[model samples]
Target: MFDVAGLWHGFQIAATPVNLMWGLIGCALGTAVGVLPGLGPAATIALLLPISMKMGSPVTAIILMSGIFYGAMYGGSTTSILLKIPGEAASVVTCIDGYEMAKSGRAGAALGVAAIGSFIAGTIGLIGLTMMAPPLAEAALKFGPSEYFSLTVLGLLLATYLTGESALKGLTMAIVGLILGCMGLDPLSGAVRFDFGVADLQSNLDFVTLAMGLFGVGEILYSLEKSGTASILTTRIENVFPKLADLTRSGWSMVRGSVIGFLVGILPGGGAVLSSLISYAVEKKASKHPEEFGHGAIEGVAGPESANNAAASSSFIPLLTLGIPGNASTAMIFAALLIHGITPGPFLLKEHADVFWGVVASMYIGNVMLLILNLPLIGIWVQLLRVPYSFLAPLIMVLTLVGVYSVNNNVFDIWVMLVMGVFGYVARKLKFDLGPLLLAFVLGPIMERSLRQALLMSNGDGSVFFTRPISGSLMAIAIAFVLYNLWAARKKNRAARAVASSEAAK
Candidate 1:
């Protein structure tokens, strides 16, 4: 069971002057990058990982990192509303309704609603974190490799489905990612695989290098190929708060989004991006005014904004409790913990309660800070957007290169990053989503290792996954999801055929 007293003690520690200062710095920096398109929290955290290790103790460092995570979630809404560009991937859905709202001169209301919704969602997610993480960790203590493997499978399926594209494309990208994950030395055997005789290849791919290139560089390439810049705002900005009617209309949407996002965020492959998309979809499906979705529906802005923030907060659960990186940003956080000589796992609550609870408590404080920071500074953010894209592009490119090279001091890593950038661009042009690719790449090695260990323990009995109670349930769920999708596809096709036949008869 979770101890509320322990979490309260954590707030006391996080409130210290130094930790609070670190939190403020992180929020400020995170907001700056997040308001700029293509710069995300993962790259920022990866860039700061080396610095965090040396800045202070692990507790203070993680407080800073967690601050950046939630801050980016809040800040991502800025460019989404004003420029119709997603400052982060999770903000993609926001661009639809948010930009529409801005076009109608309700940009401030959209921004205000996003901030308020995010604050509420973050608070809800934090309460869930305080109550749920410990119990989940305790339950996870009983899990073996088979159970972990099955859970990952289920997570991958759910992630693929929620991306709002054809599942076939998502699954294909995942297969490609799995192949990529097989690179580097065989952990169990002494032999190297897929090295192609290159000395640097023997070490396998660096997660940071791959993440930065595929997301950062790939985005730049894709965006550059598209002609035209974001529509610059020239109108006078006013009204920084939502009207009472706006609040009343979006209240339920916010509540539902918060709940859905937190649940999805607990799964291994889930994150803010998926949460936002699904929240937007649900709003469209359930709305009486469904036709208003892309034309500046407040439900569109409220649901996704709330969902992404909640999802961002809840995505930390698997990382803190199970020692698994739930998504890309958490993967970077996992790397940071390893740098600080702390292993996050089942014992995390028992052994490193301070670090665990302190980080959680700081999120509460950080969310408040983000609300305060974003509301008053909407004008500043809009003005910052006036800086030419030509100027920002070069600066971003230089920063990406410097951030990758600073930690490892390896030239090979630079080459790897560029190669991934090209690969990512090609894949995107082919209509493939990078979410599955990256998630699969990160989880592939873990899945392989888990299966091997489980087989070893079971002495080659392949049924171990099906025989185990928890693992079996998870595997069943995955199978059912596939079947359900197939059934739905057939039904949709049949409906199309019936409509065509009716037209011919007429």
Candidate 2:
């Protein structure tokens, strides 16, 4: 049975006036950041880390930040549906049918379905969080260094699979991220690995600086490369509510998406982006009119949008329960918890029940709040797209600069942002996925630490990784995935060659 008393206590804390206010502010700021072309949830949370530290209790700070996290997931779709540009990786699927819907003059319906579906998925995710978290936390207590290392390996393999186009490219980017992660002081020896004697290099590349530069500044530069200005100028606001037929069509799609998203979200380093892609693929495969997917299919818009948001919400489980962050935003949230002197792990449920349950409760409230706020204000958000690029672009640039500078009060971060922006543009042009890179950056340290610990525990034996049952199983799965992926690639190449020969014969 659910613990009613614990939930009641959580509601009491989350309902406080100050906490509620922070949640609202976070939601609004997150929405604004998401609406902007370049900024993402990770950048926004990292930028605000300094401010969050100076503010209220850990629970309240997290409440505020969580609002921003989930809100951005919701808000990213708005721009994607309105413009062809995706606000973030998680919103990429939204652009497929969402923009098509806008072009077909059903933008209102698309937006409506997105908001409603997100709300429903968010609620379901919270329910899963509330019920499943404690048991998972208990289970995580048994995870040793070997198990953790295996998990990280699995996570990297999953990243490779999720990366579009080529697994080799994803592996290359992940290796690059791991190398970049090694620039700082070694955790075990306290020795510098890649520092060139510069004081900033001594502390290593800041995650905030790297992320802000790559996603924020880099995105802006890419946008500048496009010829001519673009703006959201459409004034046709139809009914904000989904029609009865539209609801009937998308109801099951939403359920399927939520289930898949929640399960994927539980995996370390898998979150909204992977969930959205998987949901879209599943929806397309199951659709009665699969051909309609890229041409304004309602299921395309509804399914992926819901999946992304639900995945965003459920990702908190590992972070709060096992002290393992599944994504960059969750990593930032973990940083916030550490800053506030809270160590999240197996004991958190018993020791910090208020914080855990309060966060869960707030998510429920936040979902309801988002629906109420977004549905009626869809017109306002659409109008926001009408702002001239000349004005909006520079403002985004300035915000990016300020956000980078705010972290550690360092001007070096601004320079890093500029370099990263250029690199990001190049990567985008080369069709490299940034998702794998970001995940690698976040998981690199954990993987390193876990591997070292496991080796030490086994007297420096390399076979320790395969000695444990759980660890061995995970590694076996990862190996299978790699082999399968390679086999599939070869098969695809052969098929393509056969097609070319047939064309030549014709």
> Candidate 1 local accuracy as lDDT?
0.84
- Please give, for residues 392-460, the per-residue lDDT of candidate 2 as tens digits: 668767877886676578887788778887987799789886656766776778789999999998999
* TM-scores for the candidates: 0.90, 0.90
* Superposed Cα deviation of residue 333, candidate 2 (Å): 3.0
Off by over 4 Å in 2: 99-105, 233-235, 284-296, 339-352
| Per-residue accuracy of model 1 over 1-506 as CA lDDT, tens digit each | 55879888899989999999999998877787778776678767756765775776898988888888888888899999888889888999999999999889998889999999999999999889888899999999998999989877876787677663788888888788788888997767757889998998988787778877887677668767765556676655668688999999999999989998898887765678888989999999989999999999999999999999999888888888877776767877776776687877788888888998889989899998989888987777777676667766767667768777865789888888889888888887888877777777777877888889999999999999998999999899999999999999899999999999999999
Clashing pairs in 1: none
The 10 consecutive residues of candidate 2 with the worst lDDT sum are 226-235
RMSD of each: 2.9, 2.8
lDDT of 1 at 315: 86
True lDDT of residue 60, candidate 1: 90
Q: Among all windows of ten consecutive residues in candidate 1, which has the lowest summed lDDT?
A: 227-236
| CA lDDT, every model vs. true structure | 0.84, 0.81
